[model samples]
Target: MDTINTDILICGAGAAGLTLAIELARRHVDFMLVDKIDGPFSGSRGKGIQPRTLEIFEAMGVVDRMVAAGGAYPPQRKYRADGGYDEQPSTEGLAPSPAEPYNLPLMLPQYLTEGILRDRLAELGHAPRFGQELTGFEQHADGVTARLARADGTTTTVRARYLVGADGGRSFVRKALAIDFPGESMKMRAMVADLSLTGLDRGAWHRWGDGPGQISLCPLMGTDLFQLQMPVPLEGDIDTSDAALAAVIAARTGRADIALHAVHWRSVYEMSSRLADRYRVGRVFIAGDAAHVHPPTGGQGLNTSVQDAWNLGWKLAAVVDGAPDALLDTYEAERREVAAAMLGLAGKLLEAARTRGDLRRGRETQQLDLGYRTSPLACDARGDDAIVRAGDRAPDAPCRGAAGQPLRLFTLLAAGGWTLLRYEPDGAGVVAPRKGLRIVTVGMDGELRDDGGHLRTAYGFAPGEVALIRPDGYIGALASDERGPALNTYIANSLI
Candidate 1:
């Protein structure tokens, strides 16, 4: 068997793995991504992308493509048994502000989201190897060695400094690591399919019936496809056959005019929410559905998984390059807590559907306020009362550069590295600059001048203060005095 060595070995090619791969690749981290499947995922499994994830995608340089490929959540039209229809909004609308540019959730197919990440990975000079699955792995003091098996009875040994399991809920890596996954498996089964259907207005997500056996047909954005979903009859075997699925749709809708042209993809799954006992074990770790699986009620599964990738990628890169190994410890500490909270939230949403029957999502689903305010990495020595603090999401504001060009705080953070926003007045200080850090002064004669008072209002910092932004667009540390060493000390202690 051939043996390959890499800095990191990522198992599975789902959103989490792909996001981790892209993050590592952009930072020039040596890694390999492998998947058990022969080709890309086909269906729109997790279609709702939250605003926080949109911000992460912006930093990754794929937000524009994703925005172009998706559309807003359509209004829902519930079809009653009496032939009358009732209309309702699927998602609540929020106005965009300087602090929060993406105020609403975006509706894009999950496959397209993965495709965008894969394309960006290709641009970064690496591509996921399909048909290669991590069958087993062994962890050592310094690194890990994994056994990868392909379809043709071929196998290979991969050695890496660390291994991440981005594989799905029944992840081989997570199981092999002996991580305990505890959750409930629902009795009700749902049948979901992507198909071509006619006689439905494209402007709304159409639904039929009520109670535990309701059906819905949602028009997928950027494609001529409709996603059909409904509860499977408890007594009979869930039929995935094309003819049976079409029949179910026709009978449920009670409309002969609506014809299912073709069934492209289909699945029969029970709603379940699970979280691993621990996210990490020695040199091996788990993320995405492998770490925490949601019921897909609030659309938190994929968004939380993507954020997991974002949190781990930078820390892994830094550790492999000689940062403190303790930094890696914070990943589980931070993400696992969020995952636990999300598990409860998703479960509540699922219960609301069962009892209240309200499927509309709200601001909480946007994940904008999700942060690491209590994280060990957040060192706030500013002594100033500010709305946005260390470990909070670094908000964006409109500003201008020295050459009279317009700029945005998000644009300044698109480079995928550390940035120091020095709020120096008159910009007359002769200060030493740190390597691999972009130091931008935000006052007169500085590189940036706040076009409006948005920066001051959003950041709540007086002049001469500095905010240390992490690669993931979170304020890792802050100092009230621009010349203070708090930022450097925090970086040296945490990220190096």
Candidate 2:
């Protein structure tokens, strides 16, 4: 028998695992990722990138490729909610664009998103170990002992200082740790299939709530590519038979006949919102759907998981290399808050569909906000705030360098150190940062600020603003300037 010892053993090489893998790569942390699946992409899953997630990807330098692969535009479209299509596109987002305001949800399939993360991990010189399923784990003070079953019916034991479960809702790690996944499994079931939908807008997303059963038609990368989601009938069985499924759509959409193309993936998912009893149990932790599962109403599943990796990956690396144990606890505190809220928000969105307004009839789930708030750590003057809180993610705005090259605040702030950002060129007169603090100048040309629409609205940063952004991309403070009596002390404490 042979055993391998690694700094981290990540279970489930899906989005959360991939994101954590990439983050560890950036920090030079030694870890291994494993999944039971034979391939990279998974089920008929999530596809929408909420605004906050786009910023995170933009920081990781992978958004461009995601946009290229299958990221779509006009995220909101109308179709019969029960799964037959025939409706015009709809645009209800307050503002959607490509410029500094950074509106618009990036619409790409969930599998493509996972592929992008996996490709980046490989480019960073590591490939996840696939065809391995986690069997069980034993946790000691120093590390965790993990047993895995390989494709060829062989079993191997791996020891790691930490374990992160990214293996989706039915996580083996979560189950092994006896973590309770608490949430409601909804009675309604939704069917998702990626196929072709003609007579739909190529430029916008289409959905429908008017039918007896709620159905949706989403235009994908092009006019010919589309995704269909429909609610199962109240008394319907799990019927995949062609005639019955087609008949259901025809009865709901007033279209007796329709053309069909490739039905790549087809499956049903129950609306659920459940959280682990504890995101962290001893040295074992959970992330993505493993840590928390939610309703898909707001289209936040993939994006939220990516953010979870961003919050946890860096902290895990630091801990493995001898940072304080408190730093690790912060990951659970911060990301769990956001995860809980997202679940609630998704459920609310589903509930909202039951209501209607006078001006816009049949209006349901048409808009989503990139809304985020400040965590206590993001605003704390004390070191105790290391635990991640409800609202914290790096912000982005149209920015230019000293040479006037186009930049986003997130892309340039990954300077391999804690960042101090000031819209002003002079860095809000922040003196020599204690150490490990980087002073980044997000300067404006011949102006103190852009419209409130840019950085201000995206991050709620006011004019003449300055913020101490942590290296892992969370706001440390919002100041007009960094020159304050407690500033130096705060900087020194955060480093060690």
Candidate 3:
């Protein structure tokens, strides 16, 4: 067997894995991403990208492509038994603001999103190695040893400083560690497929019937195909052939005009809500579907998985760069809480779909309100109630550069690493410089001038106050003064 060595070994090249790969690659970390499948997935599963995820993608330098490839969710058209249809908004009512620019979800297929991330990763001199399967792995005090089986019946031994499993629900890494996945499987099943058809309007999301026989056909953005989803009987084998799908659509919609030309990809899955008992075991970790599984109700699975990878990527990079090993512990503490709450929300939404036929998604599904306010890494010395706390997501605002040039707060933060926003009148500061950290003053005579006091209004920062923004875009610490002991202590303990 050939032997390979790397700083990090990431298994599975889905959304979560790809996000992590881009994170590491941009940071110039030595890592390897591998997937068992022969090529990229072609399905249109997990097509909704929430507003919060859009912000993360901006930092990763792929938001422009994602926006161009996606569009707003269309109005839902529910057909009644009398052949008339009722139209209603599919998402909540929210407009774009300076603080929250991307307020609504973007409807982009998962495969396209992964392709953009892959393209970004390749630009950074890395790509996922396909046809490589992780047969098993073992952990040591300082690293992990994994065995990989190739498509040609050959094997390789990999020694990595850390291992991350982004595999699906039945993850090999989670199973090898014997992690307990404790949750209930809802007694329901559904068939999801991508179909190329004709004779149906491509503007609205069309729905037919209700209860256990409801079927929906949603038009995919920038594609000639429609994604079909329908509930399946609980006790029988489902035939996923193209002809069978076409017949079922005809019977459910009571319309012979609609046709199904081809079924590109199809899958039948039982509704389940599960969370791993633990996210980390020594040098090995599990993320994405390996850590939690949810019903396809609120389109939260892929978004949640992306956030999981975002949270872990920075912490892992920090630990590898000689930061305290305990920094890695925060990954589980912060993300596990979020995964648990999202799981419950998805379950409730699934039940509502079955009982009340409610399909309207509210602002809670946007994932903007989720944060790590109670994490051990957050520190606040303001001693006053503020809209944006130490652990909340740092909002963006328009500002002017030192030379009177136009720019946005996100543009500066998107350069990666930690940022210190010092709200002071004078840009006079000789704070000791640190790698991966940048300090920018925002005031009348500072390096960045608040365009219209929007910066202070969004962050609630006083004239002498300062806020530390983490690499993952969360506020790590806030202090009353730039030269405060609280800020120094936070950096010394958590960041250094």
Candidate that scores best on TM-score: 3
Q: Sort all candidates by lDDT, best to worst.
A: 3, 1, 2
Clashing pairs in 3: none
Relative to the true structure, candidate 2 has a C-alpha RMSD (angstroms) of 5.2
| Winner on lDDT (1 vs 2) | 1
Each candidate: RMSD to true structure? Answer: 1.7, 5.2, 1.2
Report the Cα lDDT for candidate 2. Answer: 0.67
In model 2, the worst 10-residue window by lDDT is 357-366
Cα lDDT of model 1 by residue, 1-496, tens digit? 9899999999999999999999999888999999999989999989999999999999999999999999998988887778998899998857999989998888998999999999999999999999998888888888999999899999999999999999998999888878999988766678788999889988999988776667899999988999987877556777688888778778888888988889888887887778899999989999999998877888899999999999999999988888888889989988998998999988888788766667898988888888898899898985556678898899999888889999999999988778888885545543456555787889876889986878888898688888889888889888777556766667667545
* Residue lDDT tens for model 2, 286-362: 99999888767667788778778888887787676666777777777777877777787777766655343011212
User: Which residue pairs in candidate 1 collide?
Assistant: none
lDDT per residue for candidate 3 within 133-202, as digits (tens), equals 9999888888999999998999989999999999989999999999999999898999999999998888
Candidate 1 clash figure, as a count: 0
Q: Which regions of candidate 1 fall more than 4 Å away from where they truly are? A: 234-236, 382-385, 425-431, 483-488
List the candidate numbers ranked by TM-score, top first.
3, 1, 2
**TM agreement with the true structure for every prediction:** 0.96, 0.82, 0.98
Better of 1 and 3 by lDDT: 3
